[model samples]
Target chain A: MSSLEELAQRVAEGDLEAFGGIYESLLDPLYRYFYWNLSSREEAEDLTEEAFLRCLLHIGRFDARKASFRSWAFRIAHNLLVDHIRRGKGLRKEELDANREADEPPLGETVEEEAEKRALRQALEELPSSQRQVLVMKYFSGMSNAEVARALGKSEGAVNALRHRALRKLGTILESRGWR
Target chain B: MSGRKSKEIKAALAEDLLRRVESPKAPQRLQVYGLQRILARAAYETRTVERRWFRNPALWRRAVVLPLTALLLLAAGTSGVYAASMDAPPGSALYGCKIFFERARVALTVSRSSDARLEMEFCERRLRELQGLPESGEYRAWERWSREYRRNLEGVDSLLDALPAEESAGLAARFQAQLEEHHALMEGLLKITPAPYLPYLQQASRECMERLQRLRHRHGMEEEERGQPRGPREEEGTTPVGDTGSEVQDGAEESGPCFPSPSYPQAELEDLAPYGEDTAPSGMAWTSDAEDNWGSSPKESNGVMGEGSGHEGKGSANHYWK
Candidate 1:
């Protein structure tokens, strides 16, 4: 069996050491995934922990044939993100306001470049959740289209279409800002 | 630039935009701590199965059927004509009868204690074990046990459902009375505790077996008994054998045994008890710099190789906005 499968087997068998190892290995990636979506360091950390707890709880149901351990984990993380967003318990408007305030540049840079980046972030925030998700997974986390599709429970074709539409909208936003 | 080049440029821009969007890094301690908390939770959750097992002793008794059957067959070989006759066809009604009696005997032995909590715990444990069996045509007893077990579970579900949403505060009392009724009904089935009571358990088992045998004999085939026809109202009465309304009402009035609270406190986030020390990191970390920044450093991004890099590559950039 592959290493991940072995880890999963150990996890199912209630091996804490194996679980810890798996947690250590996957924590960074999962934290990044949550952080990108939630955009708050604190919320991302909490959600990442929540996701791992959920994974531990549901380890018995993990079917390796359907998806890799990483994919399954990300799916859990994605669901946790959705739950966090829905609850609005931690970091919603506060995060956006914080980001807007922090966008103030310390070093000298061209106004056009700063404007473009700010516009891009705004455009990203404005895109439909599906489109935004595709962009986040594809570009931010560096997952392949296939992986993103599997994580999102969508067809690869659908992911590609989403990416295309998201990029087009982003281009339009940038063009309107006279940054293109 | 050609349309293709424009597309390439757009892709680069998207990549750069993403590169600029920093991914948050959790403190190493928090990751470790969270994992420990989860492991602790898992350990605690494992006890739920044990609790379920303790709640039903019939399941445990039924689990021993195969072993008891083997022992009985072995004993019969050296015994008299009656003993010889006791060894009916393996899947025959008579065989099921013997197993049922053996189960009653075992249940009686285990459930001798007057402690309702202990009895309930044993019954629940047995029930959990029975529910774990794979349903198959060959395991006829198992099938019957599964049906009864499911009915019992539904009864419990319904009983809990009948309660008001805020009844969690009074759950102990409710569970206690429900447990008492289950214990009483099971005690009625198995009377092996007091020295004089052994015969009663044996008699009850024998009666149940005889009834089952007559039912099977009337059908004339094992398959017919396996798929016994049900009356239209059969499902309505399928509540657990012991769940009378008085028992439920009594449970509501008398507080049952106090169980540990299910909800973990948010303040105890780092305390992964019983499993090990809480290795999880608190969100705050002491850094070498004079300034206390709660956010950890976003690991250095090695831009996707061969991908057109869009952002100005800057080392040591903090990922968090703050």
Candidate 2:
């Protein structure tokens, strides 16, 4: 079994300590996912903490046969993001990806590389929720194509198709915006 | 760009985007405090689930059952404490469990309507505890329960605001009915309660009733906003303007019976009083047998307070206080 599955089993069996390991492993990706949507650091932290709290409470009902722990946790995060946005807590679609690139450049990358990364994030956000989710699970959360498929309840071929389309769309967006 | 160059750039951009997303570090305090809350709650939930499995014989097949000897010993040790703690007052040793149970119920409740009812029920529990505290003649305990009562009322108000129109209407009606009963009970107690403690108790009851009324008005307005008719309970002329904080008179304005006769004898209540030599504790005044039926829905003749009433498990809005 994978480490996440192992930790989830331990947690479901009432080993409270195993939760810390799970939290450490998942916090960054979950935080980033929220931050990318919210564009606010404190709100991201609050939502991330809430997601973990929910995971702890309902962990007993988790069935490993259905999905991996990472997917389950991300699903919780996804639902929370949807709920938050539904409640009018989210920014407008244009507001979401517009300002992320305006922030400080990453430490080592050149201006061109930073601009390219910014445009990619913008295009990713602009994609449909399904495609964006696949990209996020694969790249941001570090899931493999198969893992992403399992998380998304899709086939590996389907996931590859989504990645190809997402990358192609990002390139078109960059070219339209005058990037190489 | 050529196909090979495009692939290389895609890979590099993916890496950069992923890096950008992970760069902002959450402060250590936020992480530690969050984990602490989760750990404490998990411990409480685990114990509660175990305690439940022990009593429920039907669950024996799927559950992790301990040996008979160990089971009996465990039940003897924990159940006694838990049961005692269920009735524990604010200053007592097992009082923490009462708080934990409330918090856990809120956390575990997945439905918004059910969560709202739990908050309302906990507010009532706090009020019940507050009424009982003065019976012990422990002024400190009375103060503590009073504080908790205020906090719980605030919790109820917030829950009511967050609830959808249908759920809020049911809970608001139930809360209004219960508050009327509590008001009458307090009026009876006020005659004999100690001079110093009377104002706090009176104010607490008044504030709770007022808050419930405000919630009722808010829910009524929300229903109107949705083009739904006002409930049968609302007075025809008095529309709930925003934040009016109107008064709810205890007469025919309420839909159901206002104050039923006290189920317990006045003499028994007098015997439990803390202050006056001849009078009983103020808490005993409200704990009369009639109060137990306050949580029961109006339609149910059985007066069993939502258990197995066909509204218990389902997400029915009529489940008064789950």
lDDT of each: 0.51, 0.62
Q: Give the per-residue lDDT of model 2 (tens digit) for B58-171.
A: 466336554666788987977677777889898676787777767777889897777768777877787677567545544445555656676676776777678876667778
- Which lDDT tens digits does candidate 1 get at residues B147-178? 33333333333443454544422443444344
- Candidate 2 docking band: incorrect
Judged by whole-model lDDT over C-alpha atoms, candidate 2 comes out at: 0.62
Model 1, A52-153: lDDT tens digits are: 888888888999889877778878888877877778753355567686565444355567656654566667767777788788777766678887888899
Top model number, lDDT: 2
Look at candidate 2 and tell me the lDDT of residue B312: 21
DockQ leader? 1
Candidate 1 lDDT score at position B84: 42
Clashes of each: 21, 5
> What would the TM-scores of all predictions be?
0.41, 0.39
